[model samples]
Target chain A: MKNRLKVLRAERDWTQAELAAALKVSRQTINAIEKGKFDPSLPLAFKAARLFELSIEDIFQDEVTP
Target chain B: MKERTTEAGDFTACNVKNNVRLLSWVFAWVVTLVLADKAELYEWHSSAFISIAAIVINAAIGLGVIVVFMRHLKGLDELQRKIQLDALALSMGVGLVGSFTYSLLVTAKFVIDAEVTDIILLMTLTYVVGVIVGQVRYR
Candidate 1:
């Protein structure tokens, strides 16, 4: 999955640690998600969407073509 | 104040508490295990009676370690929990394999003085390596 997490966090001027704190996850987790090494779970994706005030599709895009 | 994160990656506040409790339980289990071994070896008190008592206490503490570990897993964030679960699965597989090989060695008239502790140590080492690998892989 591809996500705009890094771009969004940068737009908000939030460090990875700050963003992690907001999401109640480790900075490593946020880093992993941004790097596409790990995909966020549904609840975590929802949390991120809520934090960013956007829909999940707005933040995350499926890399697979339908 | 700089936030403290003692976990392999970075610890959350609840994770710190979970880590402490898990460590405390593990330490207790180790201490009780040593005490039980010593009691059995030295024939302390009423020999069999003291040995049984120590073994019982040690077993109960071992159970505590298991409970604490389960809670620790539950408290971890998703990625951390996944890493831990993967490491545990690997460790368990290796432990079972080691046990079966040891049994074979014993039945084959091999005079090796290998103990169950050896297998346990191997499993622990494997789990540590597995966690480290997972962390690095995700990094």
Candidate 2:
């Protein structure tokens, strides 16, 4: 999975720590999601979507579409 | 004054307490083992009460470690918890197979001087490896 988390964060001029605090997760988790090293769980993804006021599909995309 | 974070990667306030508790658990294990060894070697068994006290102390320390370990596991995030669960499962499987193999060899009259401590050490090593493998797979 790929996500536009970095772009969204950058648009808001938010640091990873700031975003993580809002999302109730550690900064490492945000970094991992941004780097594509880790995929967030559904609840976390929903939290991120709610935080950014965007749909999950708008934030995340499948790397290999069916 | 600012709160200090230990090198264990616990960022939350609750995690700080958990880290300190974990450190105390390790300290207690070392102290209990040393005391137990001394009790066994020296003449601490001169009194039945003293002997029983030592055994009780050892058991209490072991139980404390287990309790603290479970609490620490409960505090992990979902992904980390998954990794730990998988690691524990793999380690347990390896430990059982290794112990069963050694027991069979012992039954076959093979002269193996392995003790329970050796099995415990092997299991610990296996858990460490399992955790590393899980982390690598996720990373």
Candidate 3:
């Protein structure tokens, strides 16, 4: 899975720590997700979507599918 | 977001408190054991009080450590829990196989001087390695 997390966070001027705080996760988790080292679970993806006010599809794309 | 941050902060604080408490208990338990061992070795077989105290304190501290560990595990996210479970399973498998192998070797007279502590240490080392491997696999 690939995601626009970094771009979205940048647009909102939110640091990884700030985003992690918002999501109730450790900063390492956010970093891992942004770096494509780990994929978020559906609930976490939904949380991110809610945070950014965007659909999950807008923030995350399935690289394997394409 | 603000509410969630506050919750996270609280969780971190709680984790730190639990960690500190657990460490303190373990430190006290180890110190007591060392002192007791030293007294026993020096022919200071004074009273059964020291032995009893050591046993009681160690059991209490061991229980505390387990409680804290379980609480910490319960607090982890799903993926984190899966990684930990995998690590634990791998460690247990290694521990069992290594113990049996060592026993067989001893029975065959292929090795000597193997003590119970060696198996405990081996299991601890394997568990640590398992944790590292599990983390890397998830990452």
Clashing pairs in 1: none
For A1-66, candidate 3 gives per-residue lDDT tens digits of 899999999998888777887887766678778988888999999999999999999999999752
Model 1 Cα lDDT, one tens digit per residue, A1-66: 999999999998878887887787888899999999999999999999998999999999999997
Lowest lDDT 10-mer window, candidate 1 chain B?
B1-10
Candidate 2 falls in which docking quality class?
acceptable
Model 1 misplaced regions, further than 4 Å: B1-11
Model 3 chain A: worst 10 consecutive residues (lDDT sum): A23-32
Every model: Cα RMSD to truth: 3.5, 4.1, 3.2
Q: What fraction of the reference interface contacts is present in each model, in order?
A: 0.25, 0.06, 0.23
Q: Which residue pairs collide, candidate 2?
A: none
lDDT of 2 by residue, B7-109 (tens): 2233455666887898898798878888877887886667778777777887888899989989988876666777789989988998999899878887887
Q: How big is the positional error of residue B71 in model 3, measured in Å on the Cα after superposition?
A: 2.0
| DockQ comparison, 1 vs 3, better candidate | 1
Tell how far residue A35 is off in model 2, in angstroms.
3.2
lDDT, residue B108, candidate 3: 98
Q: Which one wins by DockQ: 1 or 2?
A: 1
Which ten-residue region of model 1 chain A has the weakest summed lDDT?
A16-25
For candidate 1, lDDT tens digit of each residue in B5-103? Answer: 233335576788899999999999999998888776776666677777888999999998998999899887899888999999999999999889888
Please provide, for model 3 over B55-90, each residue's C-alpha lDDT reduced to its tens digit, 9 standing for 90 to 100. Answer: 677777778778877877777655566667877887
| Chain B superposition TM-score per model | 0.84, 0.81, 0.81
Better of 2 and 3 by DockQ: 3
